[model samples]
Target: MATPTPPVVPHQGRRRASGALEGEVLAALQRAGAPLTPREVQATLSGELTYSTVVTILSRLHGKEVLTRTPRGRAYAYAPLTDEAGLAARRMHKVLDGRADREVVLTRFADGLNDEDAALLRRLLTGAVPGPW
Candidate 1:
């Protein structure tokens, strides 16, 4: 009897990159240019991610202020608040709002600034033209 050959199976599905799913999700939202239901976002990912996984990631991003969530019927819709600069501002506001002593927080923040950044902030506060980017 001839030996039977084993059937070969190719890789079944897409593999998630080590840390690129967040970028993937964010990029998908930016490409969408509008709030997306988690299901929609998952579809944009070619269904590589489950619906619950997409929703969980969205919720986590919203909590981190990286994405904004709006009420949408039985679930929330998600969209990026803005680019990196806007996210930094949102995080700053979140920290400032959560504090009981604004002065202490501001002092600590200012203390961490280098001379160049401090001067830039001064010029910003005084309505002076900031140094060229």
Candidate 2:
């Protein structure tokens, strides 16, 4: 009889959520404070992720309009358009833009906000210059 091959073992680690890799890549770019090539980004990630994986993530982020790229030597360098807060706002706008009933959506969103956030929103709507978040 032929000998059976040993079972393949899965890597032991906590599962990463969807988009987690993208987020990590974005964070690395943001921390860089300047555009970085795929290899640089991979190095910034401490080589935890593969070079091709970093390139793919950067490409995906660029495709999503979250990042901008420019030609740098043989490879393109990537940079984020804004900080994390701006990205969050963009996501919120995207969600709102997808709905037909914007008013209802806004109302529900406002209603779900806690008192502190509601007050902050109220101040923002009233053109009041609020303090730092």
Candidate 3:
């Protein structure tokens, strides 16, 4: 019999990804419910991220239109374009829009759904139910 693999453990002092911080920043903005400067974002993270790193991540997300930024003095203030569900919906729409065959892609997606999932999707599409967290 093959030996079972050990569970992976995160290493200490490994370089954490900027994408991880981006989620944190997005959550912070959502929680704040207002635009925030990079310094404010860094502060919200409680010094876990450096000022410059946070600035770069914010700028990158803004470039992707995931976050909106407006000039605040010398730097910029950032806010999320939507809540988590809205963001996910936007991404799905973007992917569908990019593909030439919307019918085929949507057919495949709908065909893969279970009965319960299909019902939920119908309710969601008709705005008869709230979105998932």
Candidates in order: C-alpha RMSD to true structure: 6.7, 2.9, 7.9
- Tens digits of per-residue lDDT for model 1, 4-114: 999998976887763487778988998999999999999999998889888878887887678888889998889998975666677799889999999999999999999
Q: How many collisions per candidate? A: 0, 0, 0
The residue pairs that clash in candidate 3, if any, are none
lDDT of 3 by residue, 10-54 (tens): 876867777787888899999999999999999999998889899
Itemize residue pairs with steric clashes in candidate 2: none
Candidate 2: how large is its RMSD? Answer: 2.9
lDDT, model 1, position 83: 70
- The lDDT per prediction is 0.86, 0.93, 0.91
Candidate 1's clash total is 0
Q: lDDT value for candidate 2?
A: 0.93
Q: Ten residues in a row with the worst lDDT in model 2?
A: 124-133
Question: Stretches of candidate 2 above 4 Å error?
Answer: 1-15, 130-133
TM-score attained by model 1: 0.60
List the candidate 1 regions with Cα displacement exceeding 4 Å. 1-24, 46-48, 60-77, 130-133
lDDT tens per residue, model 2, 1-133: 9999999998878866649999999999999999999999999888988898889999999989999999999999999999999999899999999999999999999999999999989999887966455
